[model samples]
Target: MSALEAARRRQSWSKVTPEAPTREQLLPLVAAAGRVADHSSLQPWRLIELRGEDRIRLGEAISRVRGDDEPSTKPLRASLLIAVVASYRPSEKVPRWEQEAVASGVAHLLSLLLDEAGWGVIWRTGDYTRSPEVAALHGLGEDEALLGWLYVGGKPDRSPGSRRTVDPEPLLTALPR
Candidate 1:
């Protein structure tokens, strides 16, 4: 399927197996997202990959913050976990929010690319995303903030169902005369 077609078919898979793409298989997807529009070319984003035992560590950290014990499998739904971080840079022309938007765009592009490649992915975030403990886990800098994570793995055996068609007519508008 074409890239756009694949994008149209993309859906958030809540459950995925332990199989995932290797670094080699994922590099291209990462590179594809790098081409996203950046007003100042600040590239205000970074990715931290979590695999194997690291996923468990993340669950432990979350449990620590919540004051409860979470299952080790909680973070293991997907074979790989990619923590997307928005690292804003000092810029007079570009506002911090815009920089963060650029980062978010990159992440969406990455998820689209993964979906196109027959992988299941989900963009996950919550209150813990901005927590200090979570930030420390990824070694985020002062200017960096955790946006969310991408849980990715091979597509499951069951069908993902048909893509929903969205009409753009109502959402579009031309400049007033």
Candidate 2:
């Protein structure tokens, strides 16, 4: 299948196995993801790779943020957790929001790439994702903010099901003369 076709077939697999792409396998994909439309070339984004015991620590932090003694198993669902951080650079030419959009685009691209590579991937975000405690845990800078976490692992035995089609006409608009 073509790259776009593979991307379109991509589905978020909630239940995945522990098998995941190695750092060596992911480096090329990361490089491609970084080649996004970065205005002013600010490169206003970064990624934090979490694995093994780190996931456990993150789970604990998440539980603590929720005031629970028991740690969450959410982070353990995936073999790898990539923390997408939007490091906004102060720029008069490019606004912070635009920079954030660029970061988001890069994330989407990465997700597509992972899917194309036969890896089950999901982008998860919640109130805890934006928690200052979580940010500190991930070692994010004061100017940086968490976008979300990309949970990646091996595809489950079950199929991802068919891809749903959506019409874009309603969401499209042109300049009115």
The number of the candidate with the highest TM-score is 2
Each prediction's whole-model lDDT (CA)? 0.88, 0.91
Residue-wise C-alpha lDDT for candidate 2, range 11-98, written one tens digit per residue: 8887788899999999999999999899999999998999999999999889989999899989998989999999999999999899
lDDT score at residue 105, model 1, on the 0-100 scale? 95
Runs of candidate 2 with Cα error greater than 4 angstroms are none
In lDDT terms, which candidate is top?
Answer: 2
Q: What would the C-alpha RMSD of candidate 2 be, to one decimal place?
A: 1.3
| Backbone clashes under 3 angstroms, per model | 0, 0
Mind sharing the TM-score for model 2? 0.94
Measured over all alpha carbons after superposition, the RMSD of each candidate to the real structure, in angstroms, is 1.8, 1.3
